[model samples]
Target: MIQAQAIRLFTNRGYDAVTVADVAEAAGVSAMTVYRHFPTKEDLVLIEQPARLIAERVAASSATQPLVLRVGGALVDAARALTGGDGDAPEASERFLLDCLRLMVSTPALRARHLDSQYALQQAIVDALGVDTTDPDAAFRAQAATSACLAVMHTALTRWAQDDGQTKLPALIERALTASFGDVATGQGD
Candidate 1:
């Protein structure tokens, strides 16, 4: 509820124009309640459950699976979870997600916060893989995987948004992931 209201206000009024109080009032909650739920206004827009879900999925992947497959599967699982396993997403939900993405892209402050969130998410994935962040190789692999997943997400959302909310985000995301990692995995470029 808070997230939906925040996205609406941020999109309609501009990120800089919307205050915590405004968001709370729009959501019919107290300012304190909003602050309790989200530590900052930027956080209210940037924070999401998908990253955590991806980490969990990756952690639970079979240890024997190839790293690329494990990471790609986790990303697919997270995308599927977001879409409720169906191509049909509720109109309101789709609008909210698009609005949030727009806000992140249009607002510089929000974009910075979003990047910070991504970095933290990458660290979480690194930890989940039992990779030492201090090790150059481990760090490089984690960063690469995170970047690939984010690129897939960005492409999916951009394409979906451009389609005027017609496309299924999860399928687009899955395809983007496959196109990205598939080439590298198959040695198509090299």
Candidate 2:
């Protein structure tokens, strides 16, 4: 709840402008409590659940599946879960999601933090694949797959944010994943 409130506040007011006291007040908690949960203001605005879900899904996928397919499927599943499988997204509205994206894009500190989070996720994928990070091909494949997924997701979310009427984020994500990985699946080219 505090995190959600912090997102709303940070998105509305620029990151540098918003203080922990502001988020704490909005979340109805003490500033100390907010700091306890999130050591940094950037952490307050960053969404942790999505990354955790991605890690969990990747870890749970069948080993028999192609690495790309497993990674893509995991991403699709995470998108569905985040956007609400049936398309509701529970407490997070489309507007809020858009705001968060815009916030991340507009703020340098936030963007750096977001990139760090993504790098961590890619590492998790490498760990899940049981590949040595020092192996060039293995490392390249893991990083490429993770980067491709993130690109598709970002494009899908941007499209959804731009659309006026109701938009299905999960469907958009599925399409993005297909477009991004279809050629790879056919072994045509990388």
Candidate 3:
């Protein structure tokens, strides 16, 4: 409820124009309550669930598989899960997601924080893969694979937002991954 209020206010009143207290009041909660849930204003708009879901999917893949295959397959699976089976979120949900993406890309502060969130997500992927950072080569490989997969995701999402969410996001994601890593990305072969 707080987040919905925040997004409503942010979208209608502008992110800079609305304060946490405003959102709190709009949601019938105290400022402290809002702060307890979202440490930063950006957190009100940014969601961490996708990263967690992606990491979990990656971790569930067999460790014996090649890194690209594991990460790519996990990314594809995560993308599907995010948009639902038909590669489309409900109309209302898609609008909400697009609004959040627009806010993140348009706002300078949110753009910077989005990068930071990506770094944290990369670390989560590394940990999920159980890569030993003590081994420099392993760390480098894990980081590279994870970063590449994330890059594909970002590109697809950017395109999705640019198209005003008319295009199916999962298809865009699969296309980007396939272009970057070929058939291995589709789980056809390593």
State every prediction's TM-score relative to the real structure. 0.83, 0.82, 0.92
Model 3, poorest ten-residue lDDT window? Answer: 84-93
What ranges in model 2 sit over 4 Å off? 88-96, 132-136, 183-190
Position 128, candidate 2: lDDT? 75
Prediction RMSDs, each to the true structure:
3.4, 3.5, 1.7
Q: What tens-digit string does per-residue lDDT give for candidate 1 at 113-163?
A: 887887787777666666676799877876786667666777877787788
lDDT of each: 0.75, 0.75, 0.86
lDDT winner between 1 and 3, please give it: 3
Please report the TM-score between candidate 1 and the true structure.
0.83
Note the residue pairs that clash in candidate 3: none
Candidate 3 residues 5-56, lDDT tens each?
8988999989999999999999999999999999989999997878888899
The candidate with the higher TM-score, 2 or 3, is: 3
Residues 1-190 of candidate 2: C-alpha lDDT, one tens digit per residue: 8977877777667778989999999999999999899999888767777878888888897766667766777777887777666444343554566677777778899999988987888777667766667789977877787677777777877777677315677677777777877754323344
Candidates sorted on TM-score, descending: 3, 1, 2
Best by lDDT: 3
* Stretches > 4 Å off in candidate 1: 89-91, 132-139, 183-190
